[model samples]
Target: MSIPNEALQKILQEIGQKKAFAEQQLAIVKQQMAVKTRENRMLQLTASEVDSLPGDTNVYEGVGKMFVCTPIPDVQKRIASESEEINADMSNLQKKQDYLEKTYENSKQSLEQVLRGGGS
Candidate 1:
């Protein structure tokens, strides 16, 4: 027997909601990647500029919106460590994005089938 109209509608609605959620999550992941990329670039630029500067350089690091005098070596180390972390995070986000896209595609196909009077 065919599914009831109300039940089919409910299923379709739920599928639509899930698809929207997946899209939103995908957007968030893309934005995060952009932000991480920018941060990585900034770190590279800062390191290069620091290298060009004369020795015994004094720099101030922003800590909770306050600049504190810090040694150059420490700042460089921090930048190196954070870049590695961001790289790992980017890889993880890429995997998550791939999974979300696959799920969304499967859901979309099911929704289409249901709309065409086929079982979801």
Candidate 2:
């Protein structure tokens, strides 16, 4: 059966809209990943600084170090969790984008086939 031009155009438009939405989502995910990475780096730097302080120099150095390092583990864990989440989100987004691209290509090919009187 041959598809109408109006139907084909509508499908193409819908595909374009979906593709644009996916691109937007990917951009936001990228921005979120960047922010999370920066936060993780800052946490690591603070942890390293705390570890580098001299315990014998200050009477409260031990307490300071312990206090600082206490939440380091939690922060590290959170960073890892966030990183994993971001990776999963990006992977899923890429998969969706790939599928949409393939769909667009297939639709275009089908439209071409219809136009060429080779409907199947």
Candidate 1, poorest ten consecutive residues by summed lDDT = 111-120
**Tens-digit lDDT track of model 1 for 1-120:** 688989998999999998889989999999999998998899899889877877687888888979998888888899899889989999999999999998789889989988887453
RMSD of each: 2.3, 6.8
Give the total clashing residue pairs for model 1.
Answer: 0
Q: Which tens-of-lDDT digit does each residue in 1-120 have in candidate 2?
A: 766878866765765666566566656655765665676566567556645756533322135447333344454465568657756766775676566556656656655554566333
In terms of TM-score, how similar is model 2 to the real structure?
A: 0.50
Instruction: Tell me each candidate's TM-score.
Output: 0.85, 0.50
What does candidate 2 score in Cα RMSD to the true structure? 6.8
- TM-score for candidate 1: 0.85
- The clash count of every prediction, one per candidate, is 0, 0
lDDT value, candidate 2, whole model: 0.59
